[model samples]
Target: MSELGIEYQTVLGLPPVEFVHLAADLDCHHISMKVTGGGIYHHPAFSMLDDTALRQQFIAALRDRDVTISLGEGFVVRPAYELRDEAAALDVMAELGVTRVNTVTMDPDLPRSFDQFAIFTEMASDRGMTTTMEFAKSLTVTDLPTALQAVAHVGRPDFALLVDTMHAARSGNGPDDLLMLEPEWVGYIQLSDDTLAQRNPVYRDDSSDRRVPGAGEMPLVEMIAALPPVPVIGVEAPMRSLLAADTPVSECARQAVAGAREVLQAADELRETRARGCHR
Candidate 1:
């Protein structure tokens, strides 16, 4: 009976107000916001975050619309200057009243130990926000080594890794991968679909590339079974078919929840099976 949510990207082209409206239409309880664009030196908000008043107004509007801030995105790991910018992004999260900040693991040009990430974690912790790092097959930390490095360096439960459906599948991470992660290192999980045919694509931003949870061939059910319990499930399907299809965003949101429902059920079954096996 875990709650389900979708990324703001799912309803692309919508501003924060419109995004919340779409979330309401879909019966979604949360929406994610991005913080990066232009360059690493730029703030995570793409200049929109510069206006503290405007950002507060948007945050209030989202609350008024009865939607929770599931997450804030667009974080990058990069050079020294970029690290400062990333820290600034965390500051914005604190001001916006968001509890979690999400970013990717690729070190665009700079490689820092998990200790460096831990620093951001402490900073966000001071502001009442948590830091969640996402791994992509395309990112440098697609394997277990990088994941371990991050968790050990941060040494905090709040600064954790993101279990992404596509990343788990494309990178061949499975039950063993789950065992490798300390429960404390798991902060958030993202659900998406990817097929064997779609597996090595160099690009992932295209709309045609995405499908609803069960609609595509991603092994989401297994991936979910392998993950530790977490607070949120963020559906991030950005298929052009969904965008161009003549359906309401609410319906798509429903579909996202439906997909997650199936995964949760499967995870429950997995636990039951494991329990039975242990007894035997």
Candidate 2:
């Protein structure tokens, strides 16, 4: 069974220390966070990159809670922003024991997109870190095919691909698409669910309007069974309704984890059944 972790998007506004506390309380040892901020979420005044005192306090939080930053967020490769510009942040993440970083390339030029992302992977590997590139319909690395192309272009040992359930469903990528990947090339598998009432791909809406893992229509069990031993399962559901109702981030996290545990348990059973079938 895979361990449970929280994607920062599920509780986007929480700062590093508070986020760590939440993760500990919920028994999630791994995390994907927006450390660079970059105006992506509610960034606190305390700096994870600068401000040594704050950084130390944040580190202490992680130590006390026994939680680790599984993946560093906000390494977005945009037309205006380059991955090279994030060297300082990369150094900080490495210091904080973050070995894997994640990004989405929004640049339109495929060649440039491929090159810049590969360069980002090189930079990460230089700092004793590995990196994962995420694909989304709203971004230039739109689907599984384009994602694999970028991965091939990069062709680095440390580079890996991140596949989120919502993107796969919305972009029409299925379990077979994942089978094409070599196990080592696959990185974190983010878990999320879409409304059975309406299933469509609208980046803005789907960005936050996601249901908990077992609450909706996604094939969470099959999706997990398709992968070859992923490092972690990230619960990335951000319920806008719950947030709007002033629900505590902790409550949302608890709900997400509960649903995720059920989904992952079912996935384990499915994998077992498949193995038995093959033997038969």
Candidate 3:
């Protein structure tokens, strides 16, 4: 099984420093760090760049655990968006050796958003990071084909797409859509499941209500099979119900890893069975 990553939302209330420790304790190979945005945006933290000492401590902890800061979150580009003092976030990312940054577009103008994405990817590349565009049913870039089109327009090697399983299904995409994606265009994938049969009327809540892989009706095994060989899989199930029940973050992380591994194992077994059948 690939090293499963835990995205920040799964343990939303935890401080960034403590979050890293939980991930390390869970033996997570990678973690998606959230440096900015909060409240309705779902991320509940500010810049980890404020305190140099704290940042160093965080880095040391990750290093000791051999965990990679595989992804960074909360970089958004929209019309009339001004690049504020992003130096803090960039500095922290550099120190942590983060490789990929997540971006979302809220601007209604598709053409303008493409130009903005180009600028964002250029900035991320300058800091030795790749920019990954995460498409959702709620976002302007709603599906894989549109995401591919946007990436094509940007024409940057460092720009890639993030396929979040729940969002893919909500956006009316399926395994065939995954097949259509050029492996090079995909950077990594977020694995999760949702019980909703269709897109929610208020899509914002979807982030908090996700289920651990294989806990719901999502065709997770098939989705895994459709992915490229050895894809970097980030388990991003943020079950608010569990959180309300006062469940330990460690337990949540543990269940997420087990569920994801189960999906992968089932997919592998099915593939082997098929291979044996073909030989017969």
lDDT of 3 by residue, 170-234 (tens): 77888767867777788888888887475446777756777888998778888776766444688
Q: List lDDT for all candidates, in order.
A: 0.67, 0.81, 0.78
Instruction: Quote each prediction's TM-score.
Output: 0.82, 0.93, 0.90
Report the number of the highest-lDDT candidate.
2
Q: List the residue pairs that clash in candidate 1.
A: 35-44, 207-239, 207-240, 208-240
Angstrom error at residue 70, model 2: 0.8
Residue-by-residue lDDT tens digits, candidate 1, 81-101: 344446667777666667998
Candidate 1 vs candidate 2, TM-score winner: 2
Worst 10 residues of 1 by lDDT: 36-45
Q: Is candidate 1 or candidate 3 better by lDDT?
A: 3
Q: What is the TM-score (0 to 1) of candidate 2?
A: 0.93
Per-residue accuracy of model 2 over 79-184 as CA lDDT, tens digit each: 8667899999888888888989998877788798888888899899899988899887778888888888888889887888888887776677777776567887
Clashes of 3: 0
In model 2, the runs with Cα more than 4 Å from the true position are: 38-46, 196-202
Off by over 4 Å in 3: 37-46, 83-87, 198-201, 271-280
Error of 1 at 200 (Å): 6.8
